[model samples]
Target: MADRVLVTGGTGKTGRLVADGLVWRGIDARSATRRPFSADQVRFDWADDTTHDAALDGVSSVYLVAPTDRIDHLAAMRPFLERAVARVPGRLVLLSASSLDRNGPMMGEVHGWLDAHTSRWTVLRPSWFMQNLTTQHLPSILEDGCIYSATADGRVPFIDAADIAAVAVAALCDLVPPSGDHVLTGPEAMSYDEVASAITEVIGRPVRHCRLTTRELAARYTAFGLPEDYATTLALMDETIATGAEDRTTGEVERMTGRPATTLASFLTGQRAVLGSAGF
Candidate 1:
């Protein structure tokens, strides 16, 4: 049982759910956020080392959600993580991406750091979120009945953020800490074209996949206000996906949480009202 778990990015997609789950299970969950809007939330910023110790205070476990603004996640997070582990002597569960394998880059380096620095750690490498279609792609869908991607027919088994959180909650609450990474994914893999078709079927609206070259996609991301380097990196990931990098599924979610991961169809059904409300 976690004496006190500090969930960084408490208001974020997975962090919020992880915090709620921990609290529901009767563990003390300290939600760490730079913008504190409620009780039990402590100020925490990866850029602000001054806020680190306070967030780590009395915490027996940590749920680390890296900052999104930077590509060099290890440089931004390592100091706080080191301080956190040194002070708390507890388990640390990091939220990473399935695209980033252990010791590869970014969150991968953080995973390696955890492996070398502590015995109590868990790394969650979840695939793209199913919610991305409802949020990130929603604007594009609303603007035009199309989903744009640089990935040409690449299949991805996008996992729900809820499933990721379920596994994270279990990891954070476990008395016996897990020692390695879990590569998580949904049960089925589908391409961007198939995704558009699925959305069309679910919402009763026609939608198409608009394919682009990686360079074009990177330009699109830059136009939308991402750093050029980061945008290029993200677009390059899509190129990698095109080569079938994200084409597989894994049982990590169900294996960890003792429940089958949610399917894309079920997730879409649950979000039908939202999808339809947008005049789909």
Candidate 2:
């Protein structure tokens, strides 16, 4: 039998793409979700231990996507991970962020643990995703014709989720996947203004970037139903970007996937229809 890889958060943006890519490559891909959307998806919840064993069964490789329901996600996911390490062979690949260091919060702690325990593991630290503009930030963009942020003139090498998934599939399927941390980003760094201009060009609309204070941004997130602490932390990330923390690019994506990272213009072009229908 082919190696069966378990993908947590299978219904999510990146996880769904990863599962599809693995299946396309003729691998036995299993999606783990609390509510299985398809027959291929097994019931699994990071906060529930009862689902862990069945999800891990016959799974030689695992894709770990942390839960988003809580700010203290590491605590919620630790038990499942402990069980994974104890029960399964450790060919684990974790989805982390480029801004988060190994010792940082949430997945950062998991990165540290993966490095120390897993014999075969890869940590992907991708920068802000281009998909965020289409998904998470879409509602605001549609309603106000603007993209809101606190990063003043700071640039991010926004990567396409497809590119990230490509790299992830490579990692999960490779006989000897690259170990250690890999920082993934697009070919170039772009500011929010540039991002808005790109969207406007592709969609032929007047979408713009609306700059806000960190406090204002935090308030917006809170109004959107995030906890006060989480909202503040997210706003603080924008402040970090304003300090030029995320103003860089890397060739790791190209190196790993043997292709250059997807550009913002290209991504915008492909997503133009969706943006238009969403009130852009």
Candidate 3:
């Protein structure tokens, strides 16, 4: 049982990066995926209690990404987390969102539990990902040349998943860098409209921002096959944004990783080919 780190969402945006980062740092990184396709990956699913033991066995630390699409997921995750606390005996870094506070909502509740339960923990509350416009909203951008959101004119310091991973890797390595939740954000905040405009400039195509009501946005998420409650919660975050709730930025990324956070324009420029394919 060396100092190995178990990444729960090994195949996800940040999880893979965290795993790779750990490996690059000469750390033994174990990736936990539901379907194991590689020697480095162990089978793990939040719904399956049977898969928890093997995935957590002999691990020094865990980078937790809560079960997707399961709103109020603390109930399902507690059994495994309680086991992790006893079995792992190392850091437990959670990937929560910037909008969620300690004991506020889904992952927030998990945050509270970890604080009350253990001393070795760090909760990362990152702002919206810059990748969302390229992934989740890409279909609309390609088909209709538009980006959709309920946060009309709301600003967000959209962060790169890579930066989040960098911070997570640092947290796992340090074990106890800080005592409370770390709210990470990009260097600047901009609106979805600005995001669309940035894409337009990058791809030389007219991309518009389509504003929807919170209800409308929730419906759209459901259309994308998300559960109703989860979709509603996500859309409500947009409503929160509209009131300027997320109109701020923090230097957690740089402070943790010793690098400047990536900007939206730089990220979109890197994705120019993907974003411009349909336009051309």
**All-Cα superposition RMSD per candidate:** 1.2, 1.6, 1.4
Segments of candidate 2 deviating more than 4 angstroms: 175-178, 278-280
Candidate 1: tens digits of C-alpha lDDT, residues 1-280: 7889999989989989999999899999999998887779998889999999888889998999999888899899999988987887678999999999888878888999899888889999999999998888888876788888999999999999999999999898773248988889999999999988988898998889999999999999999999999999899989989999999999888778889999999999898877666654
How much lDDT does candidate 2 score? 0.87
lDDT of each: 0.89, 0.87, 0.91
Show where candidate 3 strays beyond 4 Å: 175-178
Counted clashes in each candidate structure:
0, 0, 0
> TM-score for model 3?
0.97
Residue pairs whose backbone atoms clash in candidate 3: none
Candidate 1 — which pairs collide?
A: none
Model 1 stretches astray by more than 4 angstroms:
175-177
lDDT of 2 by residue, 156-231 (tens): 9999999989988988887335467889999999999999998888888888999999999999999999989889
Q: Whole-model lDDT for model 1 versus the true structure?
A: 0.89
